[model samples]
Target: MLNGVSGAGEKPRVLTGDRPTGRLHLGHLVGSLRARVALQESHEVFVLVADVQGLTDHFERPGVLRRHIPEVMLDYLSVGLDPAKVTFVQQSGVPELAELTMYLLNLVTVSKLRQNPTVKTEVAQKGFGAAVPAGFFIYPVAQAADITAFGAQVVPVGEDQLPMLELTREVARRFNLLYGGEVLRAPQALLSASPRLPGLDGNAKMGKSLGNAAYLSDTQAELRRKIMGMFTDPAHLRASDPGRVEGNPVFTYLDAFDPDVARVQALKEHYRAGGLGDVVVKKHLLDTLEAELGPIRERRVGYAQDPQAVMKLLRDGTARGREVAAGTLTRVRAALF
Candidate 1:
């Protein structure tokens, strides 16, 4: 758990989501998805399939999100995100979120959205410059609507999303203050303890658009191929030459996946001192990743066999989520009128 995050409490609600970009990869697991499975024991977790949010920047590809939503839902289930344990909310199903977003827009300013570190970084990455869409620019307000609609007090997210959660808190606080009542619950960010998992090519993050991510659905042969091609020290061309351990994606993956601390440490030292070939380290990484991802693959195959069943969870969850959002909206409208 990140410092300052709330501890376990009975019936505490949590809200978090992922855009229906594609199937999740190992990077998603290590960052925050794995922790969400455990969170069900102590919290009422609501995982949103954010198709509406995906349309913000991806509006150009209309059907892209529709095609990917099922795959993303499969990825969620394969990793043991039980619908019985956690509610899987489809963002588009609830009309209340959009209404709440409109209300929240009045509470926030354009400059505040511009100043959000996360949004600013994304704008630059997308190279939107002056051409940024109004919907994409106001994502924080939409995110705030997502959290407070469930009255979620905590949100489990990666470090990059901390700024967005902070914005959610501010919006909630401003609304409650102006209304002279607690119409919305202020949400806190619960970041994972695990450092972010890097991509195969050693990028700071793994993403579908980056073309460096290794998906959970990857086959054994595919895993071996990607790991073998992972970034390592270019200076250490020969097997006898000392390789740099820092920033090496293979070693980074080992640190996250390999359980034997002593063996991993030993391997790191060997590579630094000149005898560990890149192939040796990469092969070890492949073994460690397979150990973790193998069962997930099997479960995914089983769930994929019955596509309707996996999607049924999403549909049922959306119905349940709509009930919750409807309750919140009733209270919010009363506070307004």
Candidate 2:
């Protein structure tokens, strides 16, 4: 527990999801998707396809966003996340979430939002300068709405996203204090054990905009090309040269994907001792990734072939999510009015 909020011995309500900017990639798989699949066994899980929030930066690409919503859902299904166990909600489908966002927004301030580390970093990265979108700037409050609407006790987030979760806690605490009841449950962060997966180009994080991701939907040949070309130790110019595994994306990926612990350790030792080549290591990684991704790719293809059924599953989940959100909204209304 990141903070003391969830009650002991109870099934904690969980809210964790992604914006539909693009099809999910290996980064998504390693970072949080796998964790969500595991969480569904014991806890109540709600996966929000945050198209509304995706618009913060991608408002200009509405078509792209629309196209990816089903793709994102397909990725979720392909990753062994059972829809029977997990509730999937389209952010815009649940009107209560937007209403909650409007109310929660009143509890936060523009200056406070500007001080948020995650938002500040994104603002600079997006090069928004002085023209940051109003919607983009206040998304933390909207996220708070997403959390409290389901009375989510646990929120899965990365370290970089802790600031956003803190803001959510603040909003919930303020609402409860001002409204005179536990109208909102302050959700705690469930941090992922896996570190951020670096881009194939060796960027610090794999991102859709960076064009360096190996997407879940990538063909085997595509995966091979990306893995083979992945950035590695710049100084290791020959097979006989002792390679620095630290900061090398190849080994970083091996650390993440290769399940054979002894094999990876031996490879690392051999590479450091100057006999292993990048090609050999990359070929190993490619095999490891293919073993994992091949099944996922096949499942995604099966889901993709039946888009209507996928949409039906999403609609059903959205209805269930809205029922939960509506109950929360009713409580909030009683608190406010």
TM-score quality measure for candidate 1: 0.96
Q: Can you tell me which runs of candidate 1 are displaced by over 4 Å?
A: 1-9
RMSD of 2: 2.5
For each candidate, how many residue pairs have backbone atoms clashing (under 3 Å)?
0, 0
Per-residue accuracy of model 1 over 74-136 as CA lDDT, tens digit each: 888888888888999899999999998999999998999999999999999999999999999
Query: Worst lDDT window (10 residues) for model 1?
Result: 1-10
lDDT of 2 by residue, 150-251 (tens): 889989999999999999999989988998977788878998899999999989989998999999999999999999999999999999999998889898
Worst 10 residues of 2 by lDDT: 1-10
Model 1, position 242: C-alpha lDDT score: 92
* Per-prediction TM-score: 0.96, 0.96
> What lDDT, from 0 to 1, does candidate 2 have?
0.91
